[model samples]
Target: MAVGDPTVRTTPAVNETGEGTSTILQTRDLRKEFGGLTATDDVDLAVEESELRCLIGPNGAGKSTFLNLITGRLEPTAGSIYYDRFDITGLPSHERVDRGISMKFQVPSLYEEFTVRQNLRIPLQRAVESDVFEARTRELLDQFDLLTEIDEPATSLSHGQQQRLEIAMAMGLEPKLMLLDEPVAGLSVEETAEIADILQTIQAKEGVAFIVIEHDIDFVEMIADRVTVLDQGGIFTEGTIEEVTSNPDVKRIYLGEDD
Candidate 1:
């Protein structure tokens, strides 16, 4: 598809502040440390509203740590995080969710014994300030193609199905920005493609921005409008997928060879 093709539904408009739109999420010299080690080092990043930005790096590059900082799972040793112009550095994870930010972790987090519908109801109930929780829960199950398995125990579902269900749970919150941490991590190629299509559809319909951290380069290229490459806890480079993929330095450092 063409870049920013409305029909393809990958690229959406820039943010609301005109040409130079304000970021939906921004970090200034964000840092995290474990004793003498700097897990995330002076990282600066911004995610525009409705944009699907991918964060990719080798293992131990602090991708998850950076995500933890933003989601308030781990406190930053230094710097700040702003969401929608509000300083949310001190907010708890649930409060951040309340403020229209939600996340799906790399691992499928579900209530193993609970039926699919019951598992989904947890987030539905939490996001129930204005919308009807039950209706939203039903809608998500349908949207994610989990309606058939709604009555099955979460553990009884396939790995791919469980992944979809976890994401559906996050979507139950109707978030403005969603952080998907390896949403397709353990799925098969076909399963990954299915989830990717669902994500694109959701992005098109809802205009929900996302920061996806994934190791699968193909998967990232498929969904990312912009790619941020991290190395040793800092941003090594960032550009459109086309730019980053062809970059010599990116290839040498991350891909370990010329393309």
Candidate 2:
């Protein structure tokens, strides 16, 4: 798909602000196994309210598996998952969504034949009061910079635009914490920066926490407030991007560096 599509996502300012230092999501010894193959290995993760945390590692490091476990796609083999005060260990995905958790996978999820506005309306229709549906739909359309494409079919949009649309749709559900997998994977560098900017804006204004599972080191560095590195089915280290990049173990063992 072409990257030149001009449907940039989001304009700044919804005039929203919030304050909190509580833990919104946490997992205690979270583990998932496929028979003898352990994918998520005793991961103890905590994402503070409104924090932007990124998980990055080489392929097969269990980043996706960890996401699945937290989102209720896979029941963990052992340990527990907690969201706020809820012990949501085995709750279904929709139940988690009702508790203000949502996820956007690497691929865009949109109604390909629907107009951009229609795509936004679908999720908003389900989440918002019926009297406010149209108003909220227009608000999201403007927020994602999709006002110009309000009438255009989603299938005709560039891949980058569709990614934005999908994310915007995810936001329509009013999630407190959103899990995004490789959100900028297919975009050009400029497009990457734009999406990162939009996310940062959302984080600051809406107090939304995001656990971004990504392998693009540069992209992770650009957007992550804090980072955790996973390796061979477990957390190898946790720190700021600078700290992780400079660690000799991370550099030599995973980052292909030789001393």
Candidate 3:
């Protein structure tokens, strides 16, 4: 049996449906610290295959730290991270991507000078034959609804459009699990809703799984299949959109209550 394998023994915690489900990413006693302060305190998060889990918290809630630990941006002071069936706690960022993991940061990270199509070609062209690369580029442009702006420089696109392009590039990696940090951070309501719609369509058609970190409640309600609430460095609670929203403690904490 592998160390900390769920297959060997059942976990005391059950899924949202109160049934055991296949998990794609899991952490045991995941922790990170800075000097005397603990950033992630014994966080145990489980994400099932194709599950859309959202992480939410006020500023300084450790949401970013938790993602960093999983993506290998930072090493944990103590814990183990499991992806699929392998132990990936010690893997680096690129290795994690090679293992079918990808991430989109809050800020847009693209080649602004390059056209949207060119940005995609930079990655796909390196892996596929010329014909395949061209086909993939066209497919991505259509899939992302960017055919009209295919040759336009990325900087010319609107904020929302830029966000979509970044996601499209990440999808080019054909990742199994995608981590997103505040994907709609600085967008208008319409823009945020558009992104949510695109995500739902992709999830239904392609079965892409995501672990998203966000502060926007409206955006969370639209895309979250399950919500994980973090407070002070640990997981406060997790549940469906309605469940988390209605929880008295969640309401109080989200409002910065003292009692």
Highest lDDT, which number?
1
lDDT of 1 by residue, 154-185 (tens): 98999999999999998988899999999888
Q: In model 2, where do residues sit more than 4 Å from their true spots?
A: 1-21
Q: How many backbone overlaps does candidate 1 show? A: 0
lDDT of 2 by residue, 48-99 (tens): 8899999988889999999998889899999988785677888998898888
**C-alpha TM-score for every candidate:** 0.90, 0.89, 0.89
The residue-by-residue lDDT of candidate 3 on 101-212, one tens digit each, is: 8888876789998999899887675346787877888887787778899989999998888988898888888788889999898899988988898888777888888999
Clashing pairs in model 1?
A: none
- Checking candidate 2 for backbone clashes, the offending pairs are 10-144
Query: In candidate 2, what residue range of length 10 has the lowest lDDT sum?
Result: 10-19
lDDT of 1: 0.87
| lDDT values for all models | 0.87, 0.85, 0.85
Off by over 4 Å in 3: 1-21, 125-130, 256-259
lDDT of 1 at 101: 92
